[model samples]
Target: MWNQPYLETCCRSALHRLTLVGRPGRPDGLKDGPCLRRLEGMGLARQREDGRFEATPAGWDRHALEIVPRKSA
Candidate 1:
């Protein structure tokens, strides 16, 4: 569902890092805003007890599919 360029970039960043700590406004933090809420609703993202945002396995799978294929030189 996160096929848009911006959304994919954000999700990829989150998936690659695995955890986003502290407040939602931080550059590296993922907020519980509309976008994230939708991801959470889809069982893709979750908010941790310590307020960290984490991507689920399904999220990783989806994000992985979006990775660009590298060409062999």
Candidate 2:
């Protein structure tokens, strides 16, 4: 499981086109890439060959609750 802080830091906007992590203006920041890489290493996501980082299947599993609809009573 990804650390709460790290997971919370992940960009959640569906329309967000920025693949690079960290602050919005600075794409070449020191901590951003590494932090994103660490998440990739942990199987939370994958850095695509196209330079975009996408959440892996396991990553989806980790966030399943967010995707799954609640059962109607």
Candidate 3:
């Protein structure tokens, strides 16, 4: 349970959203409220001093591994 923390549907989506850069109207980043908060609590995302949200390194890795579709090898 420690290696990979569980993520809800909303949080997973938020995590994926965090990987996106320069989103229009998203000065800080994805603001999915509770989802973002949960991700932050789980160490997946962090809020910048400017009050914007961004994915942490762990969040990026998690998104890559769990969200990004893998090509069949």
Candidate 4:
């Protein structure tokens, strides 16, 4: 199961584009930490040779599913 930290982690989700891990001057900018490393290990995200991080296809799908609220009766 996904933990709060994982769900709350900052992400930029778009239909046609993947996530960029860090942002300029953002307090929540991606840090080189365990969470990020875990994401990469799961193949949900990747760190480029240039040290930039981006979301993989699986990551994109996960993010999309996360954003949509499930209907309740």
TM-score of each: 0.49, 0.45, 0.76, 0.51
- Structural RMSD, model 2: 7.3
State the lDDT of candidate 3 residue by residue for 15-38, as single tens digits: 777787523212443357788888
By summed lDDT, the worst window of 10 consecutive residues in model 3 runs over: 22-31
* Model 2 Cα lDDT, one tens digit per residue, 42-69: 6756766656666666655555544343
Please list the C-alpha lDDT of all candidates, in the order they appear. Answer: 0.54, 0.48, 0.75, 0.51
User: What is candidate 4's lDDT per residue for 1-73, written digit by digit as tens?
Assistant: 7753354344323211334433321121345344555666767677676665566777766765676545779
The deviation in Å at residue 24 for candidate 3 is 8.8
Model 1: lDDT to the true structure = 0.54
- Model 1 stretches with alpha carbons more than 4 Å out: 1-32, 67-73
What are the per-residue Cα lDDT tens digits for candidate 1 across 1-73?
6554345565455544543432342232536344565566777677667654667777666666654334669
Top-scoring candidate (lDDT): 3
Q: Mind sharing the TM-score for model 1?
A: 0.49
Report each candidate's C-alpha RMSD, comma-separated, in the order given: 6.3, 7.3, 3.3, 7.0
What local lDDT score does residue 46 receive in model 3, on the 0 to 100 scale?
80
* Candidate 1 pairs with clashing backbones: none
Best by TM-score: 3
| Candidate 3 local Cα displacement, residue 5, angstroms | 1.9
